[model samples]
Target: MECIVRPAQSADCDHLMGMIREIAEYHNLLDEVKINSQVLSADGFGGDPFYQCLVAELAPEQEGKQGQGIGKKLMSEVAKLALARGCVEMKFTVAEWNVRALAWYRQLGAQDKTEAGGWHCVELGGEALQRLAGDRR
Candidate 1:
């Protein structure tokens, strides 16, 4: 099956949302998903977009193909976009428990910043975010 990778259009929001929910569910974080297709469309296609997304659609002619180079192709396209935007690096997070993904990324030449650079990913959100914003002293 041939995978056609391209920039995601606004019309693809529903399909994208489905994929997002599937990933979140796979990570056992489905409850953490707070956005819907409406929010996705607004945040991704509205003025001053926060991020860009790519979609890889497989040709439907082939039925039972798996473990192909689709992931690598998607990542390659992402790298091209990052380079075009003059980005110094491309970074993403994956659960440490996902050994398969970790191994795959390592094979793809991705460095483990958490291990080598002693970096910690942090989050400040929900009520904590509101509290911090309201603190003006």
Candidate 2:
């Protein structure tokens, strides 16, 4: 099978949104995805682009299919795009439970800076967020 990786365009808003929702669903966080097509287009291809995305499409796979190479190709394209955009580096967070993704990132020479205390992320959602808003009271 042939795999193609390419930078996203404004016309790809719907497809990109679908992929995002699919990923969110895979992580069991479907309800947390608030960004729609317009938001994605604005953030990615707007005046001040925040970030970029690369998509991998499989042309056709014979008898048995393998996705490893395709994934690597996609990452390679993403890295190229990042460098072209004058980004010193690209970063993405993965859940601690996703060992496979972690391994893949490591294979691609991604550093595990979690131990450096350089990055911190805070998320508020679900019932905890409701309680924080005094909604239960």
Candidate 3:
């Protein structure tokens, strides 16, 4: 039951893409996944990287089980990287209906900033993004 949490490599793009699709499917938002493995690799490993990613690799024989410390280890690695890069805080969003994930994040000392700090997560994409860009002209 040993899990290794490490930085993701370009070679992991295919596997990561699969995992991404799995989560999207779980949330019933498969159609929202527009990026493919190539995009994932470029975005994460390009000269100007958009984000950093960590991968948790478990033994081939081990079943992907929950309630283990694997997630905690991955988060710990992420926190270390953030701290090393002088980041003071980290933020992520979870679907409102995902009670289990919300509770687990809370257990990991994550706060509901949307509620406690009156923060709102906003996005503008696709046609809206194009329109906004056009307006700047």
Candidate 4:
């Protein structure tokens, strides 16, 4: 299957959201995903945009079959978009357990800063965040 990478449009909100949900689920982060079609469209196509997404589609090869090149294509496009949007660099985090993804990102020239301590990540989960939110109410 041939793959074609392109910029995402407002019409692709549903498909993008579906992909996002799938990825989140794959990473055991389904509960952390709160994105919907409306939110995706508004955030990506609205004023004061937070981020952008790239889409991959079949290039009409061999009975119009599409393949799974979306992730790579999207990564490339996101990097380009980030640079174009005045971002000095782009950043993404991968779980320490996701070796496949980590390898792929490294292959794409993403540096592994695991030893640098330049980045700090804070995650709220397992009822603590919930309790905190509830206590504030």
Maximum-lDDT candidate: 3
Rank candidates by lDDT, best first. Answer: 3, 1, 2, 4
CA-only RMSD, every prediction? 1.6, 5.3, 1.3, 4.3
**Per-residue alpha-carbon lDDT of model 3 for 52-81, expressed as tens digits?**
889999999997777888888888999999
Report the number of clashing residue pairs per model: 0, 0, 0, 0
Candidates 2 and 4 compared by TM-score, better number:
4
User: Which wins on lDDT, candidate 2 or candidate 4?
Assistant: 2
Collision pairs in model 2: none
Q: Please give the TM-score that candidate 3 achieves against the real structure.
A: 0.93
**Number of clashes in model 2?**
0
For candidate 1, the TM-score is: 0.92
lDDT of 2 by residue, 1-137 (tens): 56677778988999888888988998999998988999889999989999877777665554324455877787788778779979899788888788988888898898867756666656798799888999655
**Residue 3 local lDDT, model 2:** 69
Candidate 4: where are CA atoms >4 Å away? 60-70, 123-137
> 2 or 3: which has the higher lDDT?
3
Ten residues in sequence with the least summed lDDT for candidate 1: 58-67
Tens-digit lDDT string for candidate 1 (60-137): 776424468888889999988889989988788989999888888998899989999989888899999999999999
Writing each residue's lDDT as its tens digit, candidate 4 over 31-115 gives 9987799988999899888876677777555442223566777677777777887888767878889898888888878887774
Cα displacement (Å) at residue 66, model 2: 6.3
